[model samples]
Target: MLLPQVLPALVVGVAASLMFLGISFLSEEFQVVLWDDLPDALGIGRYSSLWMITMLTATGIAVGLVVWKAPGHSGPDPASEGLGGAPLAPGLVPSLLLASALGLAGGVSLGPENPIIAANIALAYWLGRKAQPSLPGAAWVALASAATIGALFGTPVAAALVLSEALSSQPGRGSLWDRIFAPLVAAGAGALTTQLLAEPSFDIGLPPLSDPGWGDLLAALVIAPAAAVFGLAACYLFPYVHTAFRRLRHPMLMLPLGGLVLGLLGALGGHLTLFKGLEETKELAASVGGWSSGELAKLAVVKLLALLVAASCGFRGGRIFPAVFIGAAFGLLAQALVPEVHPAVAVSSAVLGVLLATTRQGWISLFIGAALAASPSMLALLCVASLPAWLIVTGRPQLELDHEGKALH
Candidate 1:
């Protein structure tokens, strides 16, 4: 039993590793070309970084074109999908892979989770069928999803917690550990490979939390629900945004127009508010002390709206990366307004609220919030904050949009 678990994990892990490695390589090379080679070779950026805005605009248009014409509709509109899905036929894989590469490289403000998850599932199934034909199709989906998630987050435990909740809700045979054994094996291998390739760290390098005060706890209890309402505001607007864009009824027209509008937003918000926001999150954190409250507020507002536009306009990507960045910005703004509050408490609490409202994954929300400052005390506060935060959005529709441009249930 253990041998079977370990063996499939080894195979699936390698496939996932190679899949993400290729994507990272392509994304980097493409960025170099778009933001570096093309700019330098053309003597652009002489006056300002306005050239970046132009590049992002063009990227939006180009990606829209690919999504419109790509085979298999780029393997499904990301607005309607989650991070994982069933294995696709080999014939429908290429277009998704290409579109994802383009989006990742072109600075389309989306992550590679969806396409990579689907791609890994397809590859894992092909290999699994060759070597172990007895594995159920659902088992392949679980294995691939867990492996890819572990690789992406650089932690096997994330997969474990996520799968634990997911599997508990479904009817299944065997003990929970027995069902998750192979997935954990796959997660561990995948996380190890990803760390070796490139460590996936989301830390903002905040001061460690040693002592969290009562004020901090009270503020967290209050501020976190406020952030949830802030995030839920976008959720309410999501359907309207999607419906407005869908009225164009064609990706070519709708997406390019969205790109142009997004480019204008980038122009107003500057580079810090652009991209999927991993790098920019670090930039924001490092420069938090220097930024004025007004500037931080602008960043929080601009990025929030930009995320809405990008997702509503048919760009392919995941929401978690940008959502975390949004939470960080909101936290910074809170700290700016109230200098007496602890930075770690503010940031982690705001993240807890935003992520809970956005991802609706309680463990991951609290995990990410606490991990920001590496503070156990803050984790306790987020635990308190999350209950009320969960209540605020319990009956609200999710941020995802369906094919008809409506919010999901």
Candidate 2:
């Protein structure tokens, strides 16, 4: 009896792995072309303020066109979708990609990475339906989509963990086989995609812990509660904040708002907190050795608030990257508050926010903490910090979902 179920899962895993890998390759090329040539093509930096405004307006119009003409092509964002079991429609992939690209190119506060992952999932769903028609293509699409996301994020394992936790809202009641298959496909897809894209693995290089003593342990204990509180605050406040976005009543208006906000931020800081802040966050962590305590705190606050605002205000993106940046910066600041604790230890402790908010798995945060700093010792410290926060947040619902599994107002 179980064998039949297991066989189908295995098949889904294998097929999803292949599809995700292929799409990852395509996405990589797409990213490179878009990132390298588009800015120059648009003369992004050479124009006057009016020209810049006009360009942004044009981009907004484009996004508006896509969103208006195409339904379900936008909203709520990737982390929410992954958390809420939102179904994917493959036909929406082209429109979403176009809109996401326009947003990314126009310097919106959104990240294309998550949208790309989602697009691939949508693609897989469409293909599976066209081929098998009768099979549970939705599940396979999700599995394959997850695999692509993991691979693209450079930590397919972490991707797997987050998706599994999000899908299994009942904790231990869902089909364990589904959970297993999804991640397995995601890992394979992620690895293959990463390879073809020439993207480096998720290894944010931080100095190794020289001597993680009792001081470090103490710091982790302190930071754990604080991180959980911060996460809870964001989750609780999200609905109210996101309500501003819904009020726009039109993508045209919302698109311009996204561009204006992104433009003001980009013009002020030269992309400091724009985009996903993933690469920028990693760079900041590397520069921590040279930054003063004041500088670290400032960076932490800016990134955290920017990310919160972006997510809450109808920006299209994922919180995962910004969360990493926020956690890293917060960790650095925590070290300053407690001089004895290592910065690496502080970073590990800070990564628990996302875990507390949605992804309730301890290992995912631990791996992210470790991967973000590229230090096994730091990762170990994160494991210590995230466990308690995970326990605390899991018992409570972080997000409200409607019958369709969409986020509620």
Candidate 3:
């Protein structure tokens, strides 16, 4: 009975993954040119503080022009949207893509998730309607969102967990598994497609936790909530920073100004604190033994600040990836401060806390924390740690903003 829907959903999932990978590849190429090839050709150090400032500033101006002149103003400020907000009209996809690509290439401390998902949703909704006039619009939304989430994390489990939270909140028919069946299929297809092509990975190569103990539990309980508090700090600051940028009243001015500020932050934090933070998180983890507690703390703080400014000042991107980086840095800092704590325990717990605060999505937070630590043994500890952390962030202002510019709860 469901084969028809299932087949189309699978196809949409594959298409969505392809779209994400294609955009990422192009953006990375541009990033290399701006941050690598051009710098080498000009005899300028790519990571030189001055060059960082110049490139970021230039990137800001360029992105601002796109947002100002491109169709649909790049489809609303990202601060006002969540991971699966209303899909944009097809007309706005190009501008959104360009803006996102520019931001990604320009060292914006945000990820491709938001704009890419939005673009995919818009495209899926438009095309799906054309092909299957009888299918509900919500069906297309579910397929596209699931597919994107799967592709983003390189696993269908992420999509399933996220959608479970979302579905439980709404009125639905049939069993939970029954309702989620199609989306899961789509998610599986998307995850498999990305896995085959991009080989995306979340593990940061932290040592595995082969054994669990009371101390590990204690570490998780403390570190997770602490990291959540750190992330909540950003949530509290979101609206104020967003309002400050809005004062500029135009993207061209707002974005460039934001860029200049980000450049200063990059200069302060170095290249490690720049960009979306996925690869950088690995870099930090690989060299975790060498960094002092204070240096790791500074790296986390500066990256959070950069995320705040970039997301606030009209950059089209997502917060999740950067938040992951912040969590990892904090986790590493925790390990540095208390050498007895297993690196896996500290990192997973801290990531759980930060993600809990920033995303307000328990499943996603827990999943990401475990994935990064590459330690299944830490899951039970993370689950318990998440309890207090959830309380700390619950009912508090979220990182996302409403149309009135107030923080969403």
Top TM-score model: 3
Candidate 2 per-residue C-alpha lDDT over 1-409 given as tens digits, one digit per residue, 9 for 90 to 100:
3333344444444444444355434544654454446556876643344434454455556666777777665644432554324446656666666666655555444555566666656665666567556557655555555565555555567666666656666554457665466456545555655665555655566667866777787788778667766666666665665566657877667666655654454444444555566667777777766767777766665555555555554445556666776677777777767666777777777876554553455556666667766666665566676667766676655533343334443
lDDT of 3 by residue, 73-183 (tens): 899878999998787999999999999999999999999998988998999899999999888898899999999999989999999999999999899888888878888
lDDT of 3: 0.92
Give all candidates' CA lDDT scores.
Answer: 0.79, 0.59, 0.92
- How close to the true structure is residue 209 of candidate 1, measured as C-alpha lDDT? 72
lDDT winner between 2 and 3, please give it.
3
Best by lDDT: 3
Cα deviation at 118, candidate 1, in Å, is 2.1
Full candidate order by TM-score, most accurate first: 3, 1, 2
TM-score computed on alpha carbons, candidate 2? 0.77
| Residues 1-409, model 1: lDDT tens digits | 6566688886787678678878878888887887778878888862234775677677777877787777776766667776676678766677778877876676666667778888888877877887788887778788888898888888888889888978899998889999999998888888899998887787888877798788988889987898898888788898898888878988887778777777677777777777777778878888666778898888888888888888888877777778888888898889899988787888888888887777777787887888787767787888888999999978787788667667875
Clashing pairs in 3: none
lDDT of 1 at 124: 79
lDDT of 3 at 329: 93
| Per-model TM-score versus the true fold | 0.95, 0.77, 0.99
Better of 1 and 3 by lDDT: 3
